[model samples]
Target: MTNIPEGKQMEAAIQNSFNEAKKLYEKHGIDVDDVLEQLSRIKISLHCWQGDDVRGFLNKGRELGGGIAVTGSYPGRASTPEQLRDDIDKAFELIPGRHKVNLHAIYADTDERVDLDELAPKHFENWVKWAKQKGYGLDFNPTCFSHEKASDGFTLSHPDAEVRQFWIDHCKASRKIGEYFGRELGQPCVTNIWIPDGYKDAPIDRLSPRVRLMEALDEIFSDPIDEAFNIDAVESKLFGIGSESYVVGSHEFYMGYALSRRKTVCFDSGHFHPTETISNKLSSWLLFGERLLLHVSRPVRWDSDHVVTMDDELLDIARELVRGKLLEKTHIGLDFFDGSINHVAAWVIGTRNTLKALLRAMLEPVDRLKEIELQGDYTSRLALVEEFKSYPFGAIWDYYCRNAGTPVREEWLAEVKRHEREVLCKRSQGEGSVV
Candidate 1:
């Protein structure tokens, strides 16, 4: 029961623990070194909205509409593109492994008064340059919410043909931006389209809006961008703040549309009913589609988009990806905004939890477990599964973080606090506050 020492002694203890954990995993025929290497190669896209509370630079001072809201007055919300990028830089330093930045169309860095429909690759030149300099890949999305056009809780599915065309043009422009990101970065950029279009009350005609949505999406993807550069994905939601009754792009709608149109379907963890989980749908979707995009989020009561944690569902999702061998075909991205806490800490926590879950899944003796299941030894399978839960996963994770030169365990939180004192607290309330 010796107390753990400070400084140099702590490093030695962590290494000793990792050494013991490595041997324990080797007994189960798992290669700890290979698992760490695999985890290093996996990239999770960190959402930019988390740094700015979803208040994109293009629409400053506008109330967040279309069922979207960021609830918290936490200081140091990045107000400008430069500030947001700086904040993201701080977050990346605390988070291990190389990752990409996910951006909404409204985060366009140009100074010109360009609307969403007028967005071009040139507008995001600064983001591209920043990403290239940091050696990071990039992902793009067309923001269909928080605009006057979406005031009535609709965009692509809006009845007005003119309004529908406006969204269509914006999405088309967004694809071009995605293509530019991939071409410049030499990695395919997933351009995901998620529109908040549904009725708060039961609509007399639910079919029409979906029909319009289908048609609009058809027109939007009519000009096919090369898949090598830009990969298109359609995301669906169960319900949103304003649209609680009937969501036009329901799961079934997107599944039908994506499969029929040969496009990727995005499954948002927070977009499903409380009783349903995206972890169960990966195998089914991968059976038909070539690829899938995942918006890893935590939904408390509904689509709240809370920060992700290493909860049971997160572990199950990671297991499905590893067991089904769907990692290569799935694009992982964080999709939560918590203005209630330190924004950088939120990013570090969520991203690190996701990575830890993946590492845990990878360390499992899957072959042995599967063999037992096939041999009708259900008892042994269940026993092994439960027994492995108490394994020295933390030691391996600490080793990974230390090896990657990032903070180990809870060490990253101290860095977040120092940044808050030296940087975040200095921003004016007006600059940090969100509507």
Candidate 2:
């Protein structure tokens, strides 16, 4: 049984997540299965609301024989444990005993939140305890300080060292908070690190004090925290609010590559474009730069975090990553956020659809791939995806879609909404909202 969500434990980290994540890809055990599961859960939350509405979407997702793999108290430092649990409970009232949550948030803007210290630690601890009693895991996201702190969407980690240390203090307190929550709750927790400290001038010869920033995080987890906290390194793409020209790539790429091996490249699918590599076949532009080796997967539609489109080109690349065992070698997060669609329905469908597409991608051919390319023929592998006879990274989406009953739209939000309306409405008749 999983305990209920409360305070920052529920707000920052959910309960019993990795076990459910492991269970999701159990039958396949095929690396990318985990990728698909990760993407699907992200969709549920993206399509839902920042509060109770998302839990409602998750309530529907659990009934479908899957649960949300990535989610959170959302709306950043503003959420309280009580606010978060309100949403988690509504999810259960819909499906009863079927559901789970993993707390992972993007960058936090201080202007939007009250104060970091204002975070209710005890309430967060109780949520962790309750979630553990029920059987679940928790996760948190913290940002590394960089020069990008003065922006509109940047976290306060930037600014001045004193201000940065304030965040460092938050990290230390968060460790104690996480430790207390995990000790009392009986679940694993994770911390997601996405630093916005990159160069705007492109020629970044001088690597800033990023090492010190990450070291600050090390200080947080260095203590006796019982829960297994994962540090997911985010690969940022494009220039938007608080844009950073550089971000983490491969699992063992720079950053903590030399010291702690706890970091994992949480590739956001949107990097499939000029930012990261997704398709080796679509590497028409790859030869220009040797760095294409670390390209993250994405749809061909130019940097859009579409969340669902299954272009054969993008799937081929992500599949190769999985087939080469890259996907399994580290901790993975779906790495998606709301771009346009604010409604929960649009978000979940796109996420769920990507989940299905990723499953198809895992079946793509990769072993004889480089050799097959030299031969200048695509017939052999093409035959596999079209026929569904090949192993992971083979087989077309059409084949798998039939089995998952996934929707045919560009994103899965429509299908996610359909499920919520059809199934969740009846369940929520007498229950309160989870957020």
Candidate 3:
């Protein structure tokens, strides 16, 4: 049998490679050590929905509603809160650096069915405890869809007073829970509200629905929670599966609201048209908004919510953040779910790819590039940009994984498969207890 490296031998190998990589980066005026430290501080919030196919444990695995769909039927989907947390833990172990947990209102751990309007902080007590214990910051979302009240595809902008009030109460309650999360975790929780309120066919009274939406949002934000504990954000979608014709909260609507209300705005990667990228829009939005929340997801052609990859758009987004030094002003979170593979593996892949993009961006010689650009040395700038493609960035990334004590490269996949064989498979076979 071939001798496999482990223990001290593996550690020594990683250190040796990292040292060489550090020297290589120094030639380009890049501080590899400082870059690694900065990368460590960039916490990507992992979405909770990926572990359960967006099938919130609400109403006992009821079919998803409100234009949401998970296309694959991969086995080992977490059926309970405990199972989902277990899967998340496995994925987190594989990813490097400290991270945050993003939760939806439907993920509340309750014994009985809790109406959306009646949701409270108590519903999310367990999540707070888990987040505190794991040292993960908590972010929250109000479940504006997948309920009876939202069957008509309108929430927050519903025509009926009673229907609109139901969602408003739910949103208000969700903010309270978000505040509680912030207090417990000692970090401000981003309470984001996204609603699927539109029609499959074009509506004649589009303006009226938007008017109602503005009024409803006014009510939702009427009670101000201390900014120290919680911050509010509004997300807009282009068009969902059911509402392909008209979406109430289009990007224009929320952008206007954020500008007027002076609240943080959210830009979901999959929410825009395929040809339109958020990379160029960052600086523009930053000029107007104080902070922006990013939902890093992949949309094949539409808002399919596929798992994120290290594609050009993803890299550009990370580059924009690094080049503009916008990391601190942006809250990065993953928002994709692919149930066709191991859920833990999906989480690990998406989160790791996100970190990879950020690290690559940080490795760029931005100061030098900008200097050349300012001097009008377009030829040298182009030459330098092309030269950077061949740098030893992988060695530095391997060093980061080693320093973070996470499995380096292909090694993490083995660990995930082992868990699937030993744990997840048993759960699917009915040999393990969940919840």
Candidate 4:
């Protein structure tokens, strides 16, 4: 163990090797950054999803001529009128003109059981006011549904009639807000539909509500005001936890079932089964030729949404979105959050991982790669990921350890420890302590 290459050293080694490997296809004038742009465009989200890991990579990548997009967390919880205005202002100042943020679909709900008549129109005003005042280029997001009053997803799964009614009203409140967003911004302020409503143990009737709920949404879309809203069907995966089996990964299917040809398929990297191939699914989506958005992150195990990855899915998602090969009208967005870990680092790490993935995906083949590219459609990309088709970071780090007068693997392990310490410092905000 002591003689082995450390993790960070391995990472650095991997990165270096990737650079060297990059020379293999430089004939196309294509390198990592260009490929990255084709995917993520280096767009960084602000919420917890755009934390240190992402910033570190973006800073490094941009120094070498890469760009990023900004999509973040505020969009998920800003359902109230006042919250919408404040969040929008921040997005304009922090994220606008950058175009990194294609606007997020945020939810604004307070702890109180407020009547929509009292605040729904105000929610609309908050958005309109922000967009009108900013004069275009303020990329912000909107929310899906109110969940505070209705713990499970509002309007969709609530059992109490009042709870359900309240949710329906708020869904409309969300639309009212959307209208203001589209009218003032000159384009859609994205609204993603992913609900925290479902159970591994619940009856099938729980799904019954979706058809009616979709009908309601259909009615709204029929009016044409919400057409430009960038309505993405955000699909998530369920997990078996200590308390209950949760509901997830069902939204995307429903959105398809409900609207078929109308909505965009927003793929979350971690939302599928571990064996799921993002490249294959995305390719099919491209073949489908609708608008696309992405809710990206990584998995520790399948369905365990740990936002730490240098996984290749990041690359595939970014590339497909940019090419507009699938979801021809794609307006990508992020459905990212860090349930555990230093929330900041989680977001930053997620972002960095996304950037690296973008770079990897952008590694186009030369005329020599014509055969591989022809064979390397989305399905092949997934196999590449599973195949762990990567450079040897361990070998690279070993070479460096030798220069440091240390045994290769031992030096590598030490470097990994050092890196952990450094990560702890950041995570603890200088107070990181371990037992």
Q: Best candidate per TM-score, number?
A: 1
Q: Cα deviation of 397 in candidate 2 (Å)?
A: 10
Candidate 1 CA-lDDT value: 0.93
In the range 294-378, model 1's lDDT, one tens digit per residue, is 9999999878999999999999999999988899999999999998998999999999999999999999999999999999999
For residue 113, model 3's alpha carbon misses the true position, in angstroms, by 3.4
Judge candidate 2 against the unseen true structure and give its global Cα lDDT, from 0 to 1. 0.39
All models: lDDT?
A: 0.93, 0.39, 0.90, 0.44
lDDT of 3 at 294: 98
Model 2 ranges with Cα > 4 A deviation: 1-100, 104-114, 117-121, 125-136, 143-159, 175-187, 198-205, 209-224, 227-262, 271-275, 278-304, 325-330, 339-342, 361-379, 389-435
Q: Give Cα distance to truth, residue 117, candidate 2, Å.
A: 4.6
What's each prediction's TM-score? 0.97, 0.53, 0.96, 0.58
Sorted by TM-score (best first), the order is 1, 3, 4, 2
User: Cα lDDT of model 3 overall?
Assistant: 0.90
Give a tens-digit lDDT track for model 2, residues 213-326: 455556545655543432333343443222334432222333234234444334445543454554443233222211211222243444433345456654554565456544
Query: Per-residue lDDT for 1-435 in model 3, tens only?
Result: 667667778788878988897887899899988999999998898999999889787677567889888877676888899898888888999999999999999898989668888989998888888888899999999998888889889989999999999999999998999899999899999999999989999889889999999999999999878888898999999999889999999999999999999899999999988788889999999988999999999989868888899999999999999999899999999999887788899999999999999998999899999999999999999998888777778888898998888998889999988888888888777544223
Once superposed on the true structure, which residue ranges of model 3 sit more than 4 Å away at CA?
1-9, 430-435
Residue-pair clashes per candidate, as listed?
0, 47, 0, 49
Candidate 1: Cα lDDT at 211: 95
- Identify the runs in model 1 with alpha carbons over 4 angstroms from their true place: 1-6, 429-435
User: lDDT, candidate 3, residue 72?
Assistant: 76
